[model samples]
Target: MAPSRWDRLPGGRLLGGLLALGLLAGCGHDAVRRAPPRSASTRAWPTVAPADPASANAVLMRALGLVGTPYRYGGNTPEGGFDCSGLVNYVYRDMLDLRLPRSSRDLAAMQGPRIPEDRLATADLVFFGSAGAVSHVGIYVGEGRFVHAPSTGGTVRLDRLDGPYWRDHYSGAKRVLH
Candidate 1:
């Protein structure tokens, strides 16, 4: 038979055949193996159950949409701008109809499960502080990132949780949404 179309392409016949074979081989029951669970000491961070996707997505979308809105101390609404906690408050309230404490310190002390850094899910509140006093807060938006209104002359923005200043000041996180 004449060389097939796949054979006409450089290495296509051989590569395609090999890829097909590999995929077929991987379908066998024994082809899959789960890695052994890591011991607590060896684990980098603990995991937690994910938050409700609908609520989390709504909160995240609302928070992200406000990015670049100017920061105003004690401001809460989009029209008025926002402070750190005010941004968080507006997001949760706007998206989930959930009222939260207006100040970061109060929000930190509000009732909720404290989530570790690695366990944070979308919409979880990440806190920052010094001398054991919680002073700033932001909404966790997955991928070690968060959204907040940073400071005077700044605007709502996304920042990395692992950033030097944030990492050093990270007090803890709290899950307000189930």
Candidate 2:
């Protein structure tokens, strides 16, 4: 007889509970543990020149400040709230006069430096889902967390890249700023 799904797990209920709390390994499947980048500086956040709108710090701060904004599919402004891609578009356009591709898939496909997950830094655009078929994008805020307008009924918020759900779905990352 074949083993049940639960039976295949080493600790069954204990492991299930730990996964639920993001304590144990991610999803108990193909989860890869990618650590966030660290800086030599003692600052809580990574240092970058904020004077330049193209600077990573500038972009990251702008995105972080918009947390709690309502998620609006197809919406693009703070007044109207924002969707994931809209938030990215608005930030780049408003901060640097740089207009990014409108959809998450398009943004993921845009020409830029592809960054490895372990090397992700502030303001990098992190993608989720398969390559060429990415479904979500977020602004990396260092320490393995990112800010994004996740879904309908959800507000813009920060989430861990190493967390179970995201760890399993992580596709790749890109450096939007040259």
Candidate 3:
């Protein structure tokens, strides 16, 4: 039998290992390390739990209240701040006690009814990325707006889905509440 694909390359195993290490190293440097502290007004919004845990509206409300929270790599709490996925994870956990995958890519693959952009409702998770990879997520809040912890030096903020940046990077959306 002809050698398998792996045997066709010179030092294939070693090359693959180096590529993996390079990718992992690149990931750590993507997020900004430090940002200005949260402003006092950022603390004004109250994170009130909604009366109904399963309601999408309730989840949206909770998510909106988190606007202005700082962004931190791998952070999942308001105190330490939250990354995009962290913000989504925290809100769902708080509102419905539903534990979601920790990464944006995993959340995109989660088993929920897929929602087309036109049908997206409040609390639906909107995804964004390039090269067919899901790298960012946000919670839909209506009026074509979504809330998220954007990036280093950026805090949770509401952004329009129609905005050039979001519109261009739009991959798809998923409704997690249902």
For each candidate, give its TM-score against the true structure: 0.73, 0.69, 0.69
Q: Among all windows of ten consecutive residues in candidate 1, which has the lowest summed lDDT? A: 39-48
* Residue-wise C-alpha lDDT for candidate 2, range 1-178, written one tens digit per residue: 7655666677776766656678444544434545445542323444343223447767877898999999999989999999999999998888778888999999988887788766777788999985447999999888778999999999999998877788789899888776
Ranking by lDDT: 1, 3, 2
Which candidate number has the best TM-score? 1
What C-alpha lDDT values do all the predictions have? Answer: 0.86, 0.81, 0.82
- Runs in model 2 deviating more than 4 A are 1-54, 130-132
- Number of the top lDDT candidate: 1
Q: Between prediction 1 and prediction 3, which has the larger TM-score? A: 1
What TM-score number comes out for model 2? 0.69
Model 1 agreement with the true structure over 53-127: per-residue lDDT tens digits: 888888889999999999999999999999999898888887878888889999999987898777888888999
